[model samples]
Target: MNSALVRVPGTGEVSLAPADTPEPADPIAPLAAPWVGLGLSTPDGTTLARKVEKEGTEHWQQLTPARYIYKSQELTVASVFQETKGEVLSAYFGGMKFAAVGTSTPKVYRAEISSIPKGDVRALCVDWIDTVSDTEVYHHRLYLPRAEVSETEDAQWGRSQEARWGMKFSALAPPKGKTYIAVWLTDDPAVLFGAPAVTTGALDVITEDQPRGK
Candidate 1:
């Protein structure tokens, strides 16, 4: 197993935990912060030996949970406007391209922040709104981060939501839970195809601290 220590940027550093160390109370806390976007092309199961190409990393975190929170914040902001990095937000795995903003609970330029850090640990973990439709604009599937909401909501054009992982809707391509967030919308397919998308981009590297998509 690949093991190493990653430091938190803004927050104070914590000792590196053993490989797959179980920290039941750190979902909302930044533990294993990921280095900015570092691209690596590695085969499956050989993630430990993956390389790093140093691409533009939109988000960073100390541990896996922290990474999610940080990325979510950035994604939340990106949804409101198209000006974050101005990187021409590409579609994630043939999905929509959204402008990003903010560094906390961010969203695509087209969408608003739906997910939020849950759990009593402050930053131990984060989840999306159950419905993805705005509570105010029920038509758009505000941020309801649970399975029950997605199962019963009336999905509309260019909008979809899932409350739990492994329970994605057929119309939407987003995976369940906190896994790969395959985008749901974008203006150009070619541009979306330019790179592998945000989640994939993060997984491209083996030593990226993130092991999910590797």
Candidate 2:
């Protein structure tokens, strides 16, 4: 669960942040940008997608164009760990991602934390990916003022991955490219999905030979 503020691939900057909460002071503002792109990696040329916990009761939500999706419980990163369950949703649009975070919200851009240095918010930002090989080679450097950044004509694919992660990350799909992979939960946001982890390796232990839904 090693986490670090990735410098957006091109600009060497980051302009990301967690969503703010009610009372304008709840802190841990993931409530604002509840969904984030965490890490993008090169596929081992294994299965297309794999289910992490398909049968887990934590899996809920049964509506089209889901506002929120749930997953197995989440664990904390503190020396003393606590397990907590939470809603795992992937919004279809950018500003819309924070649409359901609170009652009264701030402008979409302000809601973004730009970086998660501390607190109980968990999100992943997959700003860049090499779709040709299904690998993450670059990310959006948020440090550069968004206004000062150049517009990317090809940044319309991460959303497809986000949607895949919400319901079918483990499912096999046609060969693809540039993936911004991430695992997140609100409660103990510092563990696997939030902040940086002591070790940079991920715990992907599923054996490839096993059937898709074994």
Candidate 3:
């Protein structure tokens, strides 16, 4: 017993501890924008997409319930993005035919994308992922949803900019429900996928593995 040795309790396997092992990275290390990306949960509930932008969610209330006044409030999740197209986008937006002469109702549009045909009310979720670290991610799931789209194109005839769309959605809690927004944060991808944990190390456990800032 001259030297320190570690052994498994049940198997009785003795192992030597290495002195040169590097320290684990900081799990709560700060992150930056260049290596971050946004993802939206797909319709099939199987995967994610990079269609979403870094634009954050907006939550506000005009009056506090404690104050007891006529107050206006809305809990909404919005995604601003340059116009893009795909099966997911087409299905979600209801056939991808953007026109000013539309007479259909919002309920009709939502039904087109919703896997569950809950007319007038839908459910959606978004994922905020860190590309630099590939470790941490934020997932937001909302209930009882409604969607609105606003797009603008600036035509100066000289200066040009790409048209952008703002997807405004409001979510509400259902009856007997106390939660409106559920957020999940984790460094492991398997956890996000609802699978068992199976990874480790500085990249997985600690640091985001990003470059330093100026």
What are the lDDT scores of the predictions, listed in order?
A: 0.22, 0.25, 0.31
Q: By lDDT, highest first, what's the ranking?
A: 3, 2, 1
Per lDDT, the best of the predicted structures is: 3
* Candidate 3 collision pairs: none
Residues 98-147, candidate 2: write the lDDT tens digits. 33343555633223433533322322221222222234332221111111
Residue 178's lDDT in candidate 2 = 22
User: What TM-score would every model get versus the actual structure?
Assistant: 0.14, 0.16, 0.31
Badly placed stretches (over 4 Å) of model 1 are 1-25, 35-83, 86-214
Candidate 1 structure lDDT: 0.22
Best by TM-score: 3
lDDT of 3 by residue, 69-134 (tens): 333444555544443433234323533433334466552332234444332333343333333234
